[model samples]
Target: MNKLIEQQIETLVEPLVSEKGLELVNVEYVKEGAHWYLRLYIDKEGGVDMDDCTDVSHAVSEMLDTKNPIPQAYMLEVSSPGLERPLKKEEDFKRFQGSLVMVHTLSQFQGFKKFSGTLVGLINDEIVLEYENKRVAIPRDLVKKTHLLLDF
Candidate 1:
């Protein structure tokens, strides 16, 4: 159900984000205690500002109100992906090449499930990471999650 809602929201907002010269990084639908939340992660070349978030929030709120796809009440939030942004799409990997990243896999690789290193980008459906003075290729399908690593 959460996945379905996320998909619907993503489909509905993709065009709107693009129209605003922004990129829709991701959408998440989740319940926290008694409340539900619909979170939208957005980005652009220079990154998002308060006005950008407010604009997207207003636009998405209007669209959701009209569509009424979600039966229950939920808080809608639109904001930037932040410094440690998630690396979700293939293009994200390519774009963030040479940046530091942290990756976790569904299963262990080289006796470890998590690794942090310099991102070498995507190659042959694998994410190459330069870690421990070596280049390690992690199969894309095996990755559970990945995000940029904040140096500070």
Candidate 2:
């Protein structure tokens, strides 16, 4: 049910995002305690601001309300994916090259599931990373999650 709702939302919002030159990062429909939340994470080359959020929110909200896609009510949230955004796509890894990223593997590598450092390269379906003064190649399929890291 949730997946279907997400699909519908994605279909409904694709036009709006493209029209505004924004990238739709992800969408989630989840229940937190008593509240149902439909969260939309968006981004672009220059990053998104509140005005962009507001516009997307208004447009999506109206569309959802009209279609009545979900049987239950949900609070809609449209916003940026943030600096530590998840690297879920190959395009993301390609675009974020040379940036710091943290990756968690499905199984332990070097006796650990988590690895953090610079994303040196992504080639041949593997991610090359430099961490702890050593370079390691991690298979892309092994990564359970990958997120950008903030450097101060």
Could you list the CA RMSD of all candidates, in the order they appear?
1.3, 2.3
Residues 78-139 of candidate 2: C-alpha lDDT, one tens digit per residue: 99999899887778888889899998999998788999999987889888889889998899
- Residue 116 in candidate 1, Cα distance off native in Å: 0.8
Segments of candidate 1 deviating more than 4 angstroms: none
Task: Name every residue pair that clashes in candidate 1.
Answer: none
Tens digits of per-residue lDDT for model 1, 1-152: 89998999899999998999999998999999999999999999989999999999999999889989999999998889999999988999989999999999999998999989999998999999998899999998999989999987
TM-score of each: 0.93, 0.83
> Candidate 2: which stretches are off by over 4 Å?
1-4
lDDT scores in order = 0.94, 0.88
